[model samples]
Target: MSMSALRRGRKAVVALTTALAVTLVSCSAGEEGAGMGEQQGTPPSTDFFGYQTNSRLVTTNAGTAFGAATNAELLASRLYPAAFVPGPGGQLIPNSDLVTTQEITEPSPDAPRKILYTISDQARFSDGEDVTCEDFLLAYKAGKMRELFGSQKPLANEISNLQCAAGFKQFVVTFNPGQGERWRYLFGPGTVMPSHAIAQKAGLTQEELVGALYAEDPYQLQEVARLWRYGFSVTEFDPDLQLSYGPFVIDRVGPDGEVILKANEDYFGDAPALEQLVVWPRSADTQRLVEDGALQVLDSSTANPTWYDRDSETNPFTLQSQPGDLTDTLVLSGYGLFSQQWARQAFAACVDQGRLAQVSSEKSGTEVAPAYVHVLRHSDPLIPRLDPVTNPHKKTDMELAGQLAGQTIRIGYLGPDERLAAMVQAIKESCEAAGVTVEDVAAEHMSQIHLEIDPETGLPTIDAFLGPVDPMYEYGGPEALIQNVSALRVAEEKLWEDLYDIPVSAQPRTFILDRSVENVVPYTGLSGIGWNMDRWNINEELAGQVTATSEETSEQ
Candidate 1:
């Protein structure tokens, strides 16, 4: 059948399902009446539904450049499992179910840099199609050509070639000379998609899609790009277009911003513990949701610590927190007043970072220390060896900031975060002493503050952003930061000189889970609790409820 025909059929099924749901509701209402009393039999089982807070009701998980961390975890990660996933204790481990061998060759005078990835034969999409080299090729093409593909990662540009056949299970990517070591980073997360699905959406065969990517056919690639960029939207979700190869596939996106995921029976790896998972959008009424038993788990990053009462017996959730990989920092913009190094340095010098850290700690209910270097983490071994003198911005220099007196510095933070607000207030107070006015422009999302350019001046709306930064992706260079302690220190020193980012305090990660959720481990990495969500199960016996059982699903 044609893709269009399949989509039409799915739409018809959805319409019929909606009509049937209404009929079921009407029938359910009459169950208390004598005539419908016989219709009632065994009570329906309460399926496992996991909840996570998303800021927006409608979001697209497509395009790695602009994908959100929440969508990456709750939706994309499980829907399209990456080759390497975040392991316990901040480690990146290969997915043994998909990847068999990964080899990297450094660039030499004799040979070009090459990275080879061999996938296991077991790797297959939810639709029973083999996860092939064509998918990786499309990923590479989309990531490399930013204008056409909407990818913003710098790692894509380092790749020179992606050598593969259409249905080959392996692909060798040759990188440009002097490029950094990026094996752990490539095809890791939010990069790979089912090429056949995209091809089907674009009204072409998988072979034709491969040819377009290799030939760089603009018109044909645009059709592919159109779907690749905007097809996986939650609001107008298409099950046929947004098929998952992982353990779970999206069942439906609810009207109230709840995303329902059902286990994929076609998955070849370990079966998911639960048959159904639901991700609820984050809202101010989170506590109410917990109390009402609607929310089972919350894998949150920016949620305020004070919102929940940990001791309350009425609430079914317990809040767990740890220091996360993302550090809350003042990210300077490279336009307007901040264009000058002195202006940037002066602003950084005036802001009391220690006080900012203290505020973050106090607000977050976590013991956060001031970070001096931008790149290195607080737990790094190299931090002790680095001279304190290397970081000169430890003390606030009012004299330096006085030079920019009467100038207004606008700062923004994504969403309404309490810690970020406190840090911004601290900055405002400290900078106010030097006659510099600090403006707080709280943004609904990251793009509003970072990417939205003012037409008149062509500068970002906010001069700096008070938020979290993943240093690895934010400050990647030709050499990997993890090469050695010395290299790490050098990178930190270079970042210090630039003043592009002023380290405030490490972000406190938080998770709220009901007692029914079992086998969950707190991870400090990017994916949070949802990293191994497939392993998580609801202990229904303990919670006095029966869980709905389903057939075995796909692997992630």
Candidate 2:
């Protein structure tokens, strides 16, 4: 899902290729205008619309839509900012335009581990600022080391230090012993911001910010944290502060939640294919918009969740799909009525994982397996299976769940899709049969609960929520899966307290492309579906047809 160069489309034919196979841009001047051009086709637009249901486009991947389709990496690789790009089979592909080479060293026997990245001098931000280690430091502190600023705990907490060894072009990342096994992927999905712009916004010199990063100054960190957390939001998008180091930069955010990307003429890398790219946040009517020629790419999230469930082998649009790495799974909150471990266990035992997989996949017309682990894929060998006598997805036992029938437990989730809606109802019905009350809660409210401690009660606010549980990466291997015995015990208490994550289910992403697109490849294992979208081109014949229709409609 990385469009960022440092880390990590479709249509027409029904060609079947394997999924392991797997983009352009300018510097400063954007297109004259940014519009979908569905209104009329006379001066037909080369503009394209890419849709995704998840609103989150950040790199932390900590909130709801954790690995949501609109990942910041996906946008960065396709636009301007990028570093060591991910290639086929999870290989690190360095962007010659930015980074020169990257190397990992274990250092001396007693020294800490390190990953050294040397950048090309030609790199420059859209604002004309030189790409520097200061940018990386900002991303690392704001995202991976968030605890320094009293924010939500950061992911990838294993990285001990990140600093510039020489000029801004060269940087070094030191890993904590027994941590950061996946150091190569550190900040891979994230891009560096312009320290100059961020510093100006925070009323500090770029040098001061860089110094603050190195010293971890408590006072300066608070302001840096403020800018890092909210500076790039759609509502708060600032061309100056949220500057682009990638090929494409944000020109404007539309009232309709449309993010229009214009080329950065100052970009040192390859230019973007299409002059104007419009990202359309997915909605129920997204299908109608594409069918009506208002959109060109069904390249993001599927509203139906079953949009790929076509019963036939051939689909109207070109299709590319691979078994994805991120899992869309459910999480039980350790709050309110679920404070008791047995209560969470009882809910797990009653819900049918098979039913969830069945109903959700019935749309793609393709059946899928259910998930059953915390940090490992259900199909991974290291995952402990829970079938036979230990399985929890069975019919509810009223006698066993009679701990309390009078209280209600609210379940939280994101998006407005039928799949989740169906799962929620199913979970409620199953739990009700076991004498427990269940309610639905939107994921937004639950995000606060997951990241923040309530000042009033000093505990998470929500009763329970459904969110994606990232696979092992922050920690070296699957060891984190079963790490702390005491923590595991408290999690599974009820002696059985050593386990808390009730294994539910996981689903991979299925990509549907429009009939008029090309140069799109499907990739498996983490770089998600759109690892290479910057090079995607449109089919003239099919594209022209839509233009003709638009022209005819306007004349009428």
Candidate 3:
């Protein structure tokens, strides 16, 4: 069927569904006291909560060409269901609702490694189309065209081919020999989107889109590329475009960066526990919003000290604070003076990572241990196997940094983050003794690294990036993934030798929950608390009790 015809039929179905819902609600109201609990549904499905985010929503579409994919991934994961999701403690768990079967075939001398995925038959798009292998194919094609899009996940380069018949639920993605060591994460959160939506937006059929993707002519895929790059990225809510197969769908978006989400009634999997979800901008008054019963969840990796200063009596909330999966590092740009390994090493020599970690821990009100490795986090099983002295930059040496005595190193970060700002201050203090000047340039996003290049210096305006780096992407090697601990050790050794990335500390973060909220599990993975937000709900009984107590106190 044509995309427009399908959409028209879908709209008719929606209208019918809405009329039936009204009838059902009317019938239920006659039998039960519907008005008694009408306003009790979490935020009434109409209310918007101001969720304070550390990073601004540059794009809701994660793992796209955008460099802020890490910042947007957590939010984007909520909208699109993936094959696998990061479970507790960073373990890769299959998202059963999306994929029914997933297995990796061992690589042979002749045959390469193959990842076979059997998508759930029940899986569908919010527009009432079946989730087919075409979607995955689109993702594979987009991943390979990184140069066209400007940025992409490292997994894109490992794929040799994607095999599947059109409309088939099962697809096999074959990797080049010795590639895809990290195959489990291929379609994990925010990496894939609905192919039908992209095709429809680009004014092409699924068959035509596939042909364009494989064609030698880049001009054929121009519209497709444009849609893939900037289609879903919206500051304002557009239900027609931002359809969801997941538990919740975007309802409204405010001018001040507030995103309101309502439960997806047509979700094939488990329904969302809460009816409405509000995502506020980073600059919102978080604590005040929490006290006013407007915000129930405050999950942040860079929350301030005031968030932790809460008494149980006055502030009834659960706080889960710990080290996160991301590493806060002072990454050097591969340009200008830092392009040379020795120059990168010299800059790293003056930066005391231990002292930086101390400042980060102190400012963030959490214990952030000094990190030395880029490929693995401190909690990884392979961490102990690696050589202890793999990174020699941990011990700051002023003499080595003196090589760049009069040169100024410009460092940038996704700003307004107090922790990163403190770390930058600490870096400036430590580097001054070596006569090296450190300039702090705060950027709205990471794309500034390539966009604002200085012509004379052959360097980005922001020479180095100071923020969190997902180690999965930072491993230094011809291959993106390492085979084992031994290979990882070698990769880490090479990483230290390159000296471009300086791992400062494992990121420390805290998730605070209001007393009236329930079923919030704190995972240290990139997704954080919102990983299972579809399951999160308002504790209606607790909320009722709190309301009653407040009324009683007022009467007294």
Per-candidate Cα lDDT values, in order, are 0.66, 0.53, 0.67
RMSD (CA, angstroms), candidate 3: 10.1
lDDT tens digits by residue: candidate 3, 274-363: 667777656655543443345556766554445444542334456777888888877676767787788998898898888988998888
TM-score of 3: 0.83
Q: What is the TM-score of each candidate against the true structure?
A: 0.79, 0.73, 0.83
Rank by TM-score, descending? 3, 1, 2
10 residues in a row with least lDDT, candidate 1: 547-556
Q: Sorted by lDDT, highest first, which candidate order results?
A: 3, 1, 2
lDDT of 1 by residue, 227-346 (tens): 876777776887777777788888776545567778888888988887777666665245333322345678664445444545532333567767777677777777778888999988
- The true-versus-predicted C-alpha distance at residue 134 of model 2, in Å, is 1.8
Q: By the TM-score metric, which is better: model 1 or model 2?
A: 1
Q: Tell me the alpha-carbon RMSD of every candidate.
A: 9.7, 8.9, 10.1
User: Best TM-score goes to which candidate?
Assistant: 3
